[model samples]
Every structure is written in structure tokens, then in C-alpha cells.
Target: MIPKYRQQFNQDFSQEKYSLLKEYLKQKSGLEPAFRVSESPIFLKKEFESKLIDASESIIDQIKTLSPDLLRKAVPDNCYVPGHTDKPHFLTIDFGICRSENGEIEPQLIELQAFPSLYAFQKVFEDTFCEVYPFLSEIRNKMPHEEFKNYMKDLILGNEDPENVILLEIYPEKQKTAIDFVLTEKLLGIKTVCLTKLKKEGKKLFYENEGKLTEIKRIYNRVIFDELDRILDLKTEFDFREDVDVKWVTHPNWFFKISKFLLPLLQHQFVPKSYFLHEFPENENLENFVLKPLFSFAGSGVNLNPTKEITDVIKDKENYILQRKVNYEPVFEDINGDFSKGEIRLLYIWRENDEPPILLENLARMTKADMVNVDFNKKDAIWIGSSNAFFAE
Candidate 1:
């Protein structure tokens, strides 16, 4: 973190400017985010940025060379989808800023996901932040926002017309992260189609576009298998498991394969020791580890101090992981003099199979609680929530 930039931003910070930012984002994105937006953007030094990039690449290299058997084991039979990409299109790696045993600042691997994140929303967020505070513009991403949008358009849309490419999700409008969906449509000219609304004809899929049955050539899947499985009353015409004509930008199968399940397989200094719940060693103490569901989103079903009693009651031991806890150092100093812990999520997009995913941009979450989720934070916590990271030049 850059102390000078943080101090300057705090000095210029006012209630009116923060309000204007939120209003501007609402007007631009067409929907206000349900989650809290942090008052400040995190500023990272060049050295810290390089360390994050290096650690992420090292972990990804191990995944690239994993045996087929290991990769197949990660996706359960019921959870598997029809098509499989050689590698994930979108990759998000989360690292907790922490202090090492020697009291040196370092990045620790919190988790990694092969699914899409707030890609469209993040670009607008960075722009909105810079608009409110012009001085912060110097630390923006190297690639301009418009160029990045074009890159994403090429990656997601491909050669197909935007009408043929649908951002597929279940009740997307009702989702908490629907702001991303709205912005995705605004940027890519793609429609957000609910899973239940998908119409099937033989091997082909269709969605009603402006009172016309439009053929779906590609699907940008945002449906989580676990969440979809929970909705018992839904009567969907199309199923993800069945063979379909459309291509997946990033296949659903990769979501399970590249989740917390792959944590144990990674051999990196940044990655903490992890093991399947069933494969956990009896000699090791459980208090030092955290229990996490393999595919859950937003820190759901995570136990900070996991005990044997809790691990014993879990029915599907293979679907759980016991990861060693990394102490999240409070590095972001606020105006109140209370330092807040932050988690930096490096978002990457991989268009080619041979080359590793490119680090496009990053989003950070500040928290004074045990976790970064809104449930963990108190009602009145400030300078804590959704934020973007600026690389200090």
C-alpha cells in the first residue's frame, strides 16, 4: 500500500464526494449495488503488484500441468456439464494481504475461481472513482477502459452477433450482483436471460428477444450448480447437463474443477497448506485451519476456527476443504486511525490456451470484521466494502 496516496485521498475525502460517486455509478450502471461501496480506492506499490502477479502465475502454472485424472476428480458426475474448454476463459485469484512469520508484508492465496466476476462493473467503478477524485486518475490501469471493454467484447462475443450471445443466469434481475448483468448488457449488447426462460427445440436453445424467438449461439454462464440445485420449485425447459448446440465462453464444469478443490494441489509459498476434509491428517490441530465449502461463493459456509465436531457432521467430506488460516494484516489506515484488513482479487482473462491468463485489472474489499462479506461487517463500518485497487506509478 502507498501511504502518501492513501493519506492524500483521506485528506480530500468528504461526505458529498462519496455521495456523488454512488449517484454517478447508479445513473451510469442503471442499478445501485446492494453491497456497500468503499469510500476509498486501495493504492498498491509496483513491487507489491509484481509480487501478486508472480504468485498468481506460479499457482496457475501448477494447474496447467495437472494430470487429467486429477482434473476429472474435481468435477462430480452430477455437476459435470457437456462441453469442456481446454482452460477457463475468466480466472479470479484472491489474495489476502498479510504479514509473514518474520513480520514482513506478503500476499497469501485466499482462494481462486475459474468463473466470471464483476468484470463489467469493475471498469465502471474505476471510472466513477476517478471522476469523483481526479487526482487518483494517475494510478489507473495501464489499459484504457474503452480498450479493455473492446477486449472483453471480443473475448465474450467472438464472431457471433450480440443477440446470439446471452449472459445466462437464474433470475438475473433478482441477483444481488445484477449491476454487473446490467452493465454487461450495456457494454456487450447481450441480454441477460434467466435459466427458466430458455426454450429448447431439438438440440438448439432459444430465448425470446423483443417478442421474437432468437437462436442462442453462445452462453456466458453465470449459474452456480449449488444454488441451482437448491431451487426445488423451478421448472426449467433446458438443463445444463444435456448436450446443447451453444458454446460456453467458460464452461460450467471448470467452475468446480478450478475452485477450492484445487487448493490442495497447488504448491506455492503464497498458498497455505490445504487438504480435503476426508484426507485431513489426525495429528494436525483443526483450530489453526478454516473449513470451506469447495464451490460456495462469497465466503459462505466458512468456519474460521474449524473443530472436529463440525467436520465430523459434514455428509460430503470430499466437497469440503480444511485450509490453514492466514492472518490478514490490517494495512489500510482509515481517518479514524483504525486499520482495516483488505483482500485483493486479481482478475484475469485467458483467450489462448497456450498462454497464461492476462492480468487485466483488480478489485479490493476492505473489512474490519473476520471476513470481507457484508454479513461479517458491522452496520456502521466505514471505508469497508467493495473497492478497486490502483497501481501507484
Candidate 2:
């Protein structure tokens, strides 16, 4: 972390500025985000930034060197999507601060996702942060706003007409992350169509927009199979497993293949010891372990402390993992002078057959709890949900 910037930011931060930040969010998106926005942005030094970047690259290298079968084994049963692309179009690697043996601060890998993150919203949020903090505007947008927008357009729309490309989600308007969907539609000029709204005929998928039937050529998919599985009677003409004639911006199977299922496969200095719950070694202690189900999102079904009793009730051993509980360092000071733990999520975008994915931009979270979720920080304070990280050169 950049100490100088931290001190300056903390000294300059005031409740009035937080009020302005909220007003900016409302003015830009016309609706408050369903999630919390931290009171301050993180000021990061180049050293820690490089550590995160290196850890992410190492994980990517380790993943790339794995054999095809080894990689395919990560996919859970009955979750494969057809027309798999050469690589994932989007990647997000999360890192949180933890103490090393020598008591020095180190970045530990939290989780990684091949699916897209809040790409469009982060850009706008960063801009608004800079706007609110005038002196800090010189810190630079991690990814240039105009350039990032164009890159998103390239990844989401490619050469196809925006009309033919749809940002597919499951009733996106009602979702908690709907602010991102709204901004995505405005930024990319693509309609956000619900999964049930799609009509499939033969091999073609179509959606009615503004009383006109439009053929879908590409989909910026936001639909998660786990969420889809919850609905028994919700009828949708198009299914994720079907071989529909459309380009998947990011093929759905990558979600399972690159999610928690693959976390144990990754071994790095930053990555904590993780193992399949079924194969958890008897000699290895479970004291520092947290039992996690493979497919849940937003930290659901994660047992903070695991006992034999907890593991006994697990229906499927293979579907669970025992991951070491990381001690998130209280890195940033908040309003009441109480320190807050921070997590940095490095977002990546891979274009076609690129060897290594490019580290495009990043977003940080400020939490005063065990994990970086809204439930963890229920006491209410700054730095709960979405925050920014500015790298000091």
C-alpha cells in the first residue's frame, strides 16, 4: 500500500465527500447501486501491485501448462457448454492481504473467475471517484476510460452490429447487479435481454426488441447455470446446453471449468492450501480450513470453520473443498479510525488466441469482517462493497 497517499486520503476524506459520492452514483446511473460503495478508494504502491500482477500471471501460467484432461476435469458434471472458444474472453483474479511467516504483509489469492465482472460500472465509478477527489485525479485511471470503453465494445460487439448482439441475463433488471447491466447497455449500445425472452427456432435464436424480431448473432452472456437450475417451471426456448448458432462472448462451460473447482489445482506462493473436501488429508489439520461448495456464488455455502460434523452432512464430497482461512490484514483506516481489510480483484480480458490475458483494470473492496461480502460488514461503515485502487507510480 502507498502510505503517503493513504495518509493524505484519510486526512482529506470527510462525510460531505461521501455524500457527494453517493449523489454522483445517483446522477450517473439514475439509481443507487444495490450494494455498498466504500467511503474511500485504496491507494496502492507499485510493489504490492507488482506482487498481485505476478501472482495472477503465475496462476495463468500454471493453468496454461496443465494438460487438456487435467483442465477438463475441473468441469462439474452436466455443465459443459458447446463451441468452447480457444480461451476465456474475461478473467478476474482476487487477492487479499495476509501476513507471511515473518509478519510481513503479502497478497494471498482469494479466488479467480473466468466470467466477466462489473466492467462497465467500474469505469464509471473510477471516473466519479476522481471527480470527487480533485487532487487525486492525477493518480490516473488504471485503465483509460475512453480506451477501456472501446476495448469493451471490441470484446462484446466485435464487428457485428450492436442490434444483433445482446447482453443476455436472467431478468437482469431485477438483479442486484442491475446497475452494471444498465451501464453496459448504455455503453455498448446493446439491449439487455432476459433468458426467458429468447425464442429458439431450429438452430437460430431470436429475441423481440421494440416489436421487431431480431436474430441473435452474439451474446454477452451473464446467465449462470446454477441460477438457471433453481427454476423448474420457467420456460425458455433456448437452453445453455443446446448447440445454438450464436457466438458466446464467453462460453458458459468456462465458468465451472475455471471456478472454485480449479482453485485447488492452483499452487502458488500467494494461493492458500486448498484441497477437495473428499480427499482432505487425515494428517492435515482442518483448524484453519473453510469448507466451500464448488458452484455457489458470493460466498454462499462457505463454512468458516469445519468440523467432522459439518463435513459429515456434505451430500457430495467431490463438490466441496477445504480452503485455508486467510487472515486479512487490517490495511486501511476508516472513519472512526478503525482499520478495514481490503481485497483487490484484478480484471483481465483475453482477445481470441492471446497467449496470456491482459490485466485490463482492477476494483477493490473494503470490509471490516471475515470476508468481503455485505453480510460480513453489517455493522455499517465505509469500505463495505465496491471501492477503487489507485496505483502510485
Candidate 3:
């Protein structure tokens, strides 16, 4: 997000560079990126970068303590079931932050997802960024110690047969993020099959490959329970919660274990103050907060600048949360000579038998608007949704 790098990179930006980027992506992965790749790379100060890692570690520790309880409540038959339980195991947490009034870049806990995110395409994006813009000296922000693809494979197939494992999703071809599933299939050598494509008999899940039915031993779950609930005619023989035949890559319980609803309860300094909209303390002013749906993904249903009426009409009050907004520091300088706001999604994978969560991938989002969502900044002059290239410290 530094201005100097943008000036240096954009001075050489041209139509030829864009063409080269497209060709590089097509040659490297046989796919074109869905989003724009910036001419410049994002740079993070050492102090701020360290804080980001500290924040992640702190949140993880809090999750470790409440994981058991949260997992127990995630079950359908449990006394404290939040909602549906058809999909389990995959989870992602997005931290939104900005420069505070005091000049410190602090993180505000943003959206936490219980479903699969753009895992595969993000890695591809990183590789493409490095390939197309190798001349940029500031390209190194945080180079991953391990490739995310290998890390994901290790996490999902630990002590298991890769042939028997399937990445589960619902009508994956219909999903907008189907590209990621395709990449996952290529990298891990695991098949990506729809839930409907799965055949079940006597408590086991199986899918046909080349006219042969292969038994499923483990699931790299990408299905969202909310999406599954919308389909009326879909039928399955096994229950996701009660079934014991398949193990999970990311256990279903962690979705609830590390969510925005639980962010305020955490003792981490990186997480801003948050509370359920219904139970928000009267003493705290609502003006400093943003309203968000408890289970929405990709910045959906988030009211960045909520009006009083909007807050008043909130149905299912318990299903909403008001979090103090973090002023996104316009850190990235763009081609148009304007600073762009940015947020870093540091990806981690906690595998079975591993003592700690291993950092896997890093994705950076750049926007010129007040908020980072694609919808809010589509018209911004130099907005580029891209990946960061990390250099060793």
C-alpha cells in the first residue's frame, strides 16, 4: 500500500503489461483470473505486519478454548443448535481493519464463514502476480513458507488415502466460486463431486469415478448449510451430523467456534469491540459501529454506514451483530495517483495431529472506497483485487 511503489510501477504500466499478465495466467494454469491484477504490489511495515500475525495467534488461542463447546452446540440435536447442520468442517475468518484516529492500523473482526472460500484461485492469483510483475522490487511482503496447495493436501489427506477422499460441495458447477474447486481438484489430485452425485448405502458415502463407485473415506467439505436448506427436492440417505463414516478436513465445530458472534468475547487486542444487535449495551454509541449478518459471506448484508431506521428495522435481532468499524488505511498507491484501502486475509490450516495452525496463503484486497467489498468499490478508478507477494524478513 505504499505510494512510492505505485509511482515506480505505474510509470511503466501499459496495455502490453496487461496482455502479458493474461497470457502468463493462461499458460501457467489454463485459466484467467476473475479479478484485476494491480500494476503495483502492497508493502507492509514490519511493525504492522507483526501485529497482524499477533492478532491471528490471539484469536486462534481463544478459539481453542471454546472449540469444544461451540462444536457441541453446532449439532442439530444439541440443546443450543443455531440453525441448520447439513454442512460441516470448512471455515474462514476475514478480519477488516484500517488506520485508527491515532494512526495505528488496527483490525476489526469482520466476517467469519463456516463454508469454503476462494482457496484454490487465490494461490493461482499469487503465482500470476509474481510472474507478471517480477521487476517490482517491493513485491515481497510476506512470501509463504509453504505452498497452500501442498498444505491443503497434507491437511485433508493426513494418514488417509487420497483416492478415497472427495471434496464435497452442492451443485458446484452452479456456484460462482466453482473455479476454486477446479483448481483444488488439479492440485490435490482429489475429485470434486456434488453432494447429489454421492451415493450412499448403510452409512457410507460413495461417488462414481469412470463408472466405478469409490467409497468415500474423508470429505473436504465446501457445502454451506444455508444453501442446502433452500433446495426442497434434494434427498440424501445419510445425516451430516450423525454420520460416522467420513472424517472432516476442517471439523464442523470450528465454524461456530471462531465466528464474529464470539469475537467480542475474545481477549485479543486486534479484535474490536462487538456485540449482538439485540443485546448491545445502551451505553455504547451505535454511530461508531457497522451492522453485519451473523452468517453472511463476502460482505453480504453488511451495513457500513447504517442509518438509525436500518438498525431499528433489523428482524431477527439475535441474527445480527454491530461491530465497531475500523478505518481502512488507504495504504496502496494506485496508477491514478490515489491511495487505495487494503485488507490482508492470512490463511491458516489446522491439521489433525498438528500442534498449531500453519500459515498457508495470503490474499490482499485493494479498494478505493470506504469499504472493501467488490459491490461498494466497483466504480473506483484504480481498484485492483489481487494477491500480495511476500519477501523474507
**All candidates: CA RMSD (Å):** 1.1, 1.4, 3.7
Candidate No. with top lDDT? 1
lDDT of 2 by residue, 1-393 (tens): 577777788888898999999899888887789888888888777778888888999999887877767767777657777888868899998888777888877899878888989888887888888898877788866557788888889888999999999999998888888988888988999999999999998999999989999999999999887888887898888778888899998988788777888788888889999999989989998888888889888888888888998898887899899988889889787657788888989889988857788777788888888878867776656667789888886
Q: Cα lDDT for residue 378, model 1?
A: 82
For 1-393, candidate 1 gives per-residue lDDT tens digits of: 688898899899998999999999999987899888998888778878888989999998898899868888889888788878888889999999899999878889999999999998988999999999998787788788788988898789989999999999999988988999999999999999999999999999999999999999989889988888789898989888999899898899889888999998888888999999999998989988999999899888898988788899999999999999999998888888888899999999988543878777788999999898766788888889999998774
TM-score on alpha carbons, each prediction: 0.98, 0.96, 0.86
Worst 10 residues of 1 by lDDT: 352-361
Error of 2 at 328 (Å): 0.3
Q: Give the TM-score of candidate 1.
A: 0.98
The runs of at least 3 residues in candidate 1 whose Cα sits more than 4 Å from the true structure, single-residue gaps closed, are: none
Q: What Cα-based lDDT does every candidate model obtain?
A: 0.89, 0.85, 0.66
